[model samples]
Target: MTYFNKDIETLPIDKLRKLQNERLQHQVQMIYNTVPFYKQQFDERGLKPSDIRTVHDLHKLPFTKKDALRENYPFGLFTVPVSDTVRLHCSSGTTGKPIVVGYTKKDIDIFSEVIARSLTAAGCQKGMKMQNAYGYGLFTGGLGLHYGAEKLEMTVIPISGGGTEKQIMLLQDFQSEAICCTPSYALTIAEMIEKKGIDLKSLNLKYAVLGAEPWTESVRAEVEAKLGVTATNIYGLSEIIGPGVSQEDFEEKGTGSYVWEDHFYPEIVDKDTGEPVPEGQTGVLVFTTLTKEAMPMMRYWTNDIASLYYDKSAKRTHVKMGPILGRSDEMLIIRGVNLFHTQVEAVLEHSTDFSSNYQLVVKREGTMDSVEVNIEINPELYKGLLKETSLEDVLQHEKIQQAHKMLTKKIKDEIGLSMKVNLASPGIIPRSEGGKLSRILDLRSK
Candidate 1:
């Protein structure tokens, strides 16, 4: 019920659209006159900034793809001089040079404001202490959440990421009420808590804001149950102003996260056609930085797959965006059926004997590709059912054998694929070291 900016968050929908239109017009003109990449895009389409007077005309402008950012390289897309900007952050792409983004002082303020809003949405109160576990430095997750929590007037413990011992120590000693990190890393912390036999009540943690990678409700359930916190999804990408782009309200839970539409206008478009899809349908989510000064991106393609819709019965008037299913780039085509790791996560969540820690390994057998899922059994279940047996001898256990067969059949019935399942003991599978965990290991190319 506590909103950071209640007026803006509860503004009338009609007024919200007007605010977006006005900001969009100014943003279009600013980018058209400033950034050459956008200017060239305008020229190629024989369109002027005036042509984009409203959100409806967004379709007329060509989509700004990630390739444009790479082609522009460092500072090429920046609208202001480097001296005028206060900070710079870039993507951690494995190949080629990383895609750099600049932020002016005012833009940094915008970032802080959105993050404050996000933290508030995640049930972070003004006086609550926050243990920021997000990575710092070139990655924006750390600093972005740091300043925002401060903006929300909460005490901050800048632990950054990794070092589970230190994280737990701070959580217990400091009695921080909130924690922010990737969901996978949250699970790692939770699993460590169990292995070390740390009493959940020893930690005063109450809320967890998890993002950076796509996750499922199954992962959320694990984090909440283990940490004894109300966990919510906080989604954002470096290209679109980091982790405050949208946030799931603590009370709202499974509905969806509210997209702060007044600043960053959002649209769901067809991944292939680049045309806007009907409201409430799943597609690639795109955004235009309506209020950004240093790097005002117009129709920047996020490549994240999700749907946008208005929750008429929601607390906030801003549009709500569904959970990110998967990125178009990360999706896999097995045989003919498309698959996202989340689909498998959903099945794992329902299975009482399995833990959410899992990996999908895709390999080529002859000419066809085969997927094998290596998942860990619940530590408690392992302790009760097969503590005497070695992990390699797990399949020899009759209950393990039955669970494996049931899991495989469930996946086949639900996901429409018969994938080989390997049930490993807890700690056998790799855990996230306070970073984004890669669930899919497609080794076909290698």
Candidate 2:
């Protein structure tokens, strides 16, 4: 297989560990001397940079949470001056002040390198045309993919996001070989193609690198089957340097994405205790940017729940991380039962009557938490149902009632949670328009 950087990608485990240790020590010393937040963390813990000479000592360092970034505001945590940094990116900050991160020229180059490696892993080749559908301007996804595609010597369309008509138009006209986008948006494109009766053969798209939101294997199967492309996951956060920290190889399929441990040291820790978890067990994923220069984060708690393990038969020596199950904060506890939207998705995936476009609505009713799943019936199933009854009376149809009863029972049996299910028309549910689509609506907070 063609690799962007085969030497580092296939490095020996011992050598990779040693490289991570050296980078970790340098990063610790740099943060200790430069950023006051890290410096204070060291002093408050009664530790010094010298104490962290290897990756094993990383546990001694305090976990850097998002609250710490917000407290720092604009550039308080940055090691270099803003003028010296090449670019700045920030969160949407809908809830509060946006957490901003800066990148130096070197940092930007490293970002491109990792993304190039990711695209290569996702079955992209040099000279292939890549249509980047990620949003640009401050969101990291757009330019991150653009520069990396360019670095891989692939022609990038830089389409940015939205404009479904234009996205489909260019896919046919340009005959792009690869596409980068969120999984939901890719589904939207696939749906539009079906509605417009666009022949899949007219497009040259072969690979899809999807991320920025947690997705399930069902979503991958849907996108791949509809778009006629191999869908792979590319994972990263702006805090850790965009969407290239790790990537799933197209050939490996469902195994796991390989984390580039040389640049970013990863660890899985207990969500509540903050202690490291046993290998191959699910926990919160954490990372320390070993080579980041502008905003090197040490043990940044991603809050994303996933497990890390090594695949002995894999091509890369780096540790492989399972698909992000769900964010610990985003997980819902309904009436004493913990529920992740993906768990519900897994249940629905087994049934052909419902579409993947579904939402979980959580509400509090007199101190009792209730969850209602809003799911859209598959268009084909809806048509078959409509033949038996009118649209207004479809909910009363015998088949509809039977399917609903089966779904409720399956969810209760599989997830151990009883949830109300609302089956709607094919187009009633909202679809993503080239952006991260939230699947859960927690009205309890509102």
Candidate 3:
């Protein structure tokens, strides 16, 4: 219900650092003693476990990248022996080779505590029946939340994902109070609920912990309106022990997720320079898993870009990371202009009164690069405008022009990118056959 470990969760700044230092020291020793990969890294750097004393000393260690995890494959990074490993989870790398992570029983318990804290921060309580719709299997989202909910004594319905009928049926019959899944899935489920004429008010759902993909505030509002539940963004990666690294405490507005700094240390650095950026400035998120048992990462580059704000009201110094602005690797340069997919999505979020389902198509026309946005407007909204004897068809084109102009200016101001935009009819944009949404399609011959 409340803090799982109240002492640690609310530990004073000085005490928390002390705890972190101890954990960091222990983790370093464990890695040096057991994990060959870390042993080699430390040896190459001429460093010893004792070299890392305070949490700030983490910088002395080399940053871990996704490639390192991939290169290690299944178990090269394990600080503990495989015999002590209790669980294994692999990322759903739709792009290439999947990154695998192993967790000991102690590691799993720590992860559960972190997720439990996330649920509590989002106001989930004991005895509340929660429907966890996040994908389970090798992906850590579903199971991470599943164990956390159970640890918090909340009754959990492990509905995996992608069955709209079953999800609604359980929401009705079980009177589930919360749902956890990707933001896109939440919207898709809301669309299904409306299509099926389900009474959202009758369902006892109160909160939705949505993440796994970048989503806009407009989508959050849409989900809340359709499902009649307060929505919160929960962020994490399989590399950092999923779903509990950071979470938006809705009580604090859109102040971003409050990073659980006790378990994992957080930092923001200039993407190019790799130096620490100012607190309010946007930069790529880097993390160090200070207390993980199976795999402890030191200065792992997360690639996510956002600004970090320290929230003092919570008494626990929580790191508030802005909405994942975009991925560092997803940045595109067109005619000496740099831009990201989230910037395009931000423009769409403000200018479109349509369904949030959309796509960004980037292609090279001759030697010039062009960007086009394909969006779908709701028929009902269009009908309302058409009733005023205003030709909705013509107005749609005007809206497109307006969106294009606003987006072009915004992109130019934000990232110095000049782009072209286009709009498409509702349901025209492609959806992932596997039920997930792909945000970008770069047709540029790389």
Residue 327, candidate 3: C-alpha displacement in angstroms: 1.1
- Report the Cα lDDT for residue 25, model 3: 87
Minimal lDDT window, size 10, model 2? 90-99
lDDT of each: 0.91, 0.92, 0.80
lDDT score for residue 409 of model 3 = 73
Each model's TM-score, in the order given? Answer: 0.98, 0.98, 0.91
Q: lDDT by residue for model 2 over 1-446, one digit each (tens)?
A: 87989999999999999999999889989999999999999999999999998899989988999999999998999998899998999875578888898999999999999999999999999899999999999899999999998999999999988999999999999999999999999999999998899999999999999999989889988999999999999999989998899999999989999999989999999999999999999999999999999899999999999999999999999999999999999888887787789898888775787899999998999989899999987888888878888889987788878988999999999999888999898888888888898899889879
Which pairs of residues collide in model 3? none
Q: Which segments of candidate 1 are over 4 A away from where they belong?
A: 387-392
Candidate 3 runs further than 4 Å off = 350-352, 383-417, 431-436
lDDT of 1 by residue, 279-306 (tens): 9999999998899888888888998999
Candidate 2, after superposition: displacement of residue 70 in Å?
A: 0.6
lDDT of 1 at 196: 91
User: In candidate 3, where is summed lDDT lowest over 10 consecutive residues?
Assistant: 427-436
- Candidate 1 lowest-lDDT run of ten: 386-395
